[model samples]
Target: MNSFSELCSLLNQVSSADYKKILLKEYLDSSTDSDILWALYLLSGRKLRRSFDITGLWEILPKLAGLPEWLIDESYQISSDKAETISLILPVDPDEKRITLSEMIKFADDISELPDSAELEKIINILKSINAEDKLLFLKLITGAFRSGINKKDIAAALSEKYSITIISAFHFLSAADPYEDNPDNLLKYYKRNKKIFSSYPFCSAQNQDTASVFQGDCKQWLAEWKWDGLRVQVIYRKGELLIWSKSGELVTEKFPELFRLSQFLDDGTVIEGEIIAFSKGRPLHFSILQKRLSLKTVPVSLTDDFPAALIAFDILEFNGNDIRSMPLTERRKILASVTEKSADQEIMYLSPLLEFKSWKALAEIKNSAAENNCKGIVLKKKDSAYSGNDWLSLNLEPYIFNAVLLYAQRSLNSEMYSEFTFGAWHNDELITFTKTSGGLNEVDLIEISDFIKANTIEKFGPVRTVKPELVFEIHFEGISESKRHKSGITLRNPRIHRWHKDKKPHEAGYLSNLLELLNAGK
Candidate 1:
């Protein structure tokens, strides 16, 4: 097999998530060969896709990090077309046999017998000759990430152990490596010595309280956030490198480039967590504004001017090599505030506003005005609280709203037969036989629906089975519109549950015809 194919095979097997540490562990003992490096590149992701097939040396090179098309080309058209040629230069065979991960490692070593360093350089240079389209794939191959398995956290740890450096340092090293760049093998086991408590820290949620008065008495300090309509991002600047990850644990450094610029003002090894909101000069931008920016693999210059993101620093997890997640919110606040550079921050950053509502009544009053001030709601933190559970309550989950769907029944994707209760809806039409329905069920109602599905499975559609639609579920939606995709061709906009009806009848529900009438009436 060709060296690149062997590398690809190795990457495909190692699980993109697990390969970082695994590669460090296996290759740390001695210097790596070209084939080994190639495997890393392919594993990292050396193909444009299953299509655009540049499986060869093209996938492992880095692109011009900060260049814009306008600067490179006088006519935007020429630059756009030429951009595709990048993939052409980094060619992989659609018809060629692909190798396996195990074979890839062995072949890398075998190819290592060749003019070792020269082959590695040759691969990297080949990658550079290609256009930007293939650089990511090229780097993935060289780095031994097939982009299929393995998580990056493990990879960082492996790098730390192999290089005998800090975990944050190892992340930087991996991110900075050139494709076909090889490091030592024993990297995995080497970095496990400094494990910190990444244990859960959160505020209590409103769901847990279940009382209108729960917000009335605060045993501890309390804070309020708008639950801003954006992403929960964690920015970790470690060892002269910057990484920004999302709540889902996906490293989204490239997704938002502007945030990375914070390294210029913040501590190199500090790790911070907060909400990342797309904003205008000084105001919170709409979710759509952020959505447009997020779609880009790299934010564009136009977007930079239009929608910039600012980190609303909420909590400090680590500082100066110390893991402080275990520290109380009160303590973390002190460290977080101390570290905030007065002159270093741009308009994109600001401290989250906090307040102590003397009573739940006060909190409710503030919540009424929160929308006008771009806040989600009031967050209550009990006095003397320690970070605890996985459900932010483990840390302490202040009553927060997370919109989820009821995925069963006629409206749900899972339990069509789970609930026997017929759902209720107001008549959407006055002039038609069917009724339109929506915007009734809230998140709680959906959970009730899910429970009904899970506990009462009977029939099956793929992995989903039926118990009964005995539970009448009303789907709450942001808006409703007619759709061809659904049965009535009536569509829901961001629909979730409004509430579960425990005391209502199914036929009393709004019919499709009634819904159409309502839509007409609203119009």
Candidate 2:
């Protein structure tokens, strides 16, 4: 591959977007015209990012020739205004063949014997000629900071399609696994060798079900659990050694080592998926326990003691060295239950307790009592069904997406959305008045409401002022409840993010039926 293509391939593997842009410019401006192929593919959406990051590309090139860490560091720190001169200059030795770090490192020892001033000037010009994106890609490659516009998966898919390979095969290629290893006769296999893992990073998912049937089908035989406001954990342990992963697919083992201890609670070898909640006594604890342990490099004795965590396992992905993810919900739960029972310590592996309901009314009862039960919300799993896709989002959170009328909204003084709102929170205790809004909107509705809030400000409720709750906001419901703490008689349960309503009037706010339907659907 030409230098630009090779560089693009490397850059495609990187995750950060900002860094990629920087390197892209550098390479494009200073790189040799012969290496223009890499520059061409930078916009192809067909390459992996590893070729650009100094760290990832280091394996390919001679270490000595790879851009110096100190150089990138010096260029990296310069102010944007000064970066032009200090960091990205014209390339040097522009006509020199693109060489791997391994090759360059070997050549480094012979630098004294090579051409001096002319060769040096050429390389500098090549560096300068590399376009901004290419330069950023180069800098990030050398400095290991290639951030690109797209993600690894997206790049993988695009490249897979371009090269006529399966997405999984593309993943294998990006990940450095030889998906085509068995097919040596195949020409593609040659290039496919030593492929990288496309990604271990979690991806954004669409959890919505287009034709979601809430009112129909079975509401009975449904189960409920308090959706704790903590991190979702997927624990994997083969033979003793355990690892905890977050929903975003990040390795959080270093973050919460105490959770690894819970592996001892299980009887045999197994992999379990559950939410890790703060626990006190035999019950789940508050989400606030996470604050102390989030980003710490070293585990503190006090923090570990302060926010002790527990796993409320729901599904069993792997057991006894077998992957059971494709198993039906009924089967998965059965295994999960069995694993918990077999566990030496019952507390380490407790079956997530469920509240069964026969109808929508039963589901509503459970949802209302969620706060009392210390649950953020309830998860409605269709019994005997298998887990699939974003079905989780539809089953768990959709019922709460009610068309609640905007009770009152005002322009927020916050960042993006220029409107602040006070709606409802449904807690069994006392549905308190919970509000959400933004003030950064420069739109027609925000412009109008921004004026209205200023004119109608009543009293300041700390950061939020009590405005005449006049405008209607169509906030989607995530869950509901009656909280004793709220000013609104009852609150909208764990409300989800949705769009603002500019057309609807305040008087048309949602009704009790709006919430009832959701409760029944959820149940």
Candidate 3:
């Protein structure tokens, strides 16, 4: 292994993107070509193939550090980071040998192929030559868990600054091919070869606006579309290949095979942004249902029958291999309508309908019907605004009842008083708090719920008892707003328990996105 402890130290010291970029660029300028390639893969969020698993790491750590297994286990429980736990338990090396990034990756690959009898001695020898900090990085790389604060965009920024190219171009270059095998010189060559092709573009987000302020705007210059509850995605079809990118730039094509098959109908070199919704009998289902359909390589026949997938395209970024982001939204919408009607299957792909309104008063009445129509709110986009930089606004119709899971319960300060239940929704696997209320349940209901909570308690933090997420309750809130204090990033206003939804599962609980839509609309 070549000396590469400096890189780990740099990563530990900086948190800002700018500083991280500077350090990366500096290292790339001085490091070997192989080291630069490995750095590019790690900084750009590429997961390298793991040669070993952490299951053996526990057994290996004790022998390497001459420490008891219990000591390492206790440290891991406190830190909750496997890399950090191993690093903390290992002895520090004063005369550590410097290992290059490529050499380290190669060594990990070599270790994975070693027999179980020989692997422990080999791992210990490698650890003995490196300090704790570099050992953590090495272990992380071997385990394919090398996530730092930096992301692909940060690496792109550094590349763009160093090479004097656009950040978007850098993104395209990095995404076009594997960095481990693709040389830096290929960035320009790849860019020139596919300069006309459209890559994923950053989503133009909306600013929150009050209900009255949004309606008072010029109705003639604004275009209204229903804000469907689904995953926002960008679908690009270039040179007979289709790709689906989520809002966060994640490649989610394999997750929705049905959507990928439908995207095959799009014209080559076309890019459209839309929502991937789960629909049944031609009506969109809740976001919870859509969540179940995600992260899947193939949908089962039984599940697909219950929740079919569909795409609702609303905006066009490119047409016929030409960039049209600079075009006025109204004109682009016309072209989009024409193309969708010509090439897309009406049953699978939908062009979002535009609503015509004479005034704010007229629109207000229509928005009130959102709940009945399965619409969360209405998106107001300026007709004359360009697609890339235009500031869109969302107007939420009303706050609807949402199903949340019971997270933790706490009794009121007065012992004779009622118990307050902390309610939260599931964000992926995490249960995040949105509201706490004690007003909805009666004396009998409180006693029943309190007894259930006590029986299912997992842990206690002061006065609060953290219970298992087995109970589902329907909650109603007047409005939603951004709150830094909450884990969900938003809080509900005037939240109260509507009723207990005993039939619902924890995974079916409402998401933070449920409140974010209304909070985003009102902002």
Candidate 4:
């Protein structure tokens, strides 16, 4: 426990990527296999299930520390982190012994199966056995809020360097094998095998580039397709079983049962890369419709009928138990077209249509009409580029912008100062809340806004403060839609603060009717 806690502290203090790799390799070399596996699991941004509710911790802390509840709350307000607050206030024992990371994981797993009272008792005893630093990590683990600066890429790079293998091989191994369940020997075997039934290849992400630069060469060298706004997925069919893996490496086979029919058209050991969209009536619906299908564990027949799911296949990574990622895009596209042609009659699958353009100006004109066709933009891939090559580019539409007045402010969980702000647009005679954003501001702007929030408060509701609507901001968003859930009868997608509108008056802010007009125009 102490060693793991020390490693976490060291990782938090460093910012250099190369230095982080060195630290991870050193720790991996010195730690036991069990400890190494657990470390990778946590450092790669995967968290264990919360064994107990966080509110339970607040109740237990006041009793354990013999401190007033109000004082604890005040400290929490300042630190803005529960683990840090609890670790600071808890009483430390000089004779406490350290436990191994594997032992700590076992304790958490064991207590999750116990009754509420028994779990609480075991938690208290364990908390008392560890020092304050180790307790912070332990509490973070149990609460499922563990975070280290390192990411999956860093871990894979470390392993690649250590074992003298390609980074892609490391990524495939990590994605296929569950660190929590697989032992060191099993992990080695899987790495050696290099391929598994449910394993996903490292996704090839496109680089964002302007139209001029992307099309500077001969336009015929690039193949364009409409960039669909949907969840990126890889559908795998192997050994008569079908599995769906999201871009984040999550297994989501059961979420969209409508996709199960795809197995009939796919051959054994075939893996098709595509977007899972909420498609109906021969057109793609808004992304919010697809979001509704994601949360339910089981899809009812009626729900599936209303918001049917479909795959717009983009490429093929494997064909008939063979990896084809090394093939050029032109060759791979032929193979993909042939495979998807078998499912032409099926509504659940379709090939993402390739766009025809002879010049950059022609492609730009096509991009201008993308939103009306329910596409984000166009994707351009070099005709002869390999799947593993970095030759793909995405040219997206400019985000819609609106001038809105600041209406509310709130302190974020990571900072005591006011960081989150709600903005509103005019609706007839009143300003109605339309969106909120916490990003796109520098340190100076954040401090200035915090001061404004403090001085112009109109009312307070818990952590949120109703602010005087005097400041205006330029808000940018991807899309807008009318919704009954919002008080303003409207919502914006991916809204963020574009800039502080220092020169604009609050009364000059955009009206809700303008946003509604834009929404209707897209439809």
For candidate 3, the 10 contiguous residues with the lowest summed lDDT are: 1-10
What's the alpha carbon RMSD for model 3? 10.8
Pick by TM-score: 1 or 3, better one: 3
Candidate 4 per-residue lDDT over residues 1-523, each given as its tens digit = 2388888888888767777888888888788888888888778666776646667777778988999999999999999998889888988877787777888888899889898878777887888888888888888899888888776668787877887655544655555556577886677665556446646788888888887777676888889999888889999898776888788655667778888988989999899999988876878987777766675546688978988888999999999999999899989989999988998887888888999888889999999888877778899999988886388999999988899999999987658688789998899789999888888988898889899899999999988999999999999888877778889887788899989988889899999989889888866
Candidate 1 regions exceeding 4 Å error are 1-177, 184-207, 211-213, 218-226, 286-296, 324-331, 343-345, 356-359, 383-472, 476-523
Tens digits of per-residue lDDT, candidate 2, 396-452, equal 333344333333454333343335565643345323355453432447766666677
Clashes of 3: 8
Per-residue lDDT of model 3, residues 76-100, tens digit only: 8899998778877877787886677
Model 1, span 1-523: residue lDDT tens: 3334322345445534455355446543333444444343433333322222233322332232233434334332553433233433334545434333334344344444557446655444444444333444444443443353434556556655655666454544444444343442433333333333122223223333433535444434555444555677767766565677667544567767666568777775577777788776577754545655555545687887777778888677778877676777778777777766552446655667675556656656666665444444445543344444221321122222212222234333233323322233333422121223344545565566656676776666654444443444445433334544455545443434445657654444455554556445423
Q: Rank the candidates by lDDT, best first.
A: 4, 3, 2, 1
Residue 197 miss distance in model 1 (angstroms): 14
What does candidate 4 score in Cα RMSD to the true structure?
7.3
Judging by lDDT against the true structure, name the best candidate.
4
lDDT of each structure?
0.49, 0.50, 0.75, 0.83
Which window of 10 residues has the lowest lDDT sum in candidate 1?
393-402
Candidate 1 all-Cα RMSD:
12.6
Candidate maximizing TM-score: 4
Q: What is the lDDT of candidate 2?
A: 0.50
Better of 2 and 3 by TM-score: 3
Model 4 CA deviation exceeding 4 Å by range: 1-195
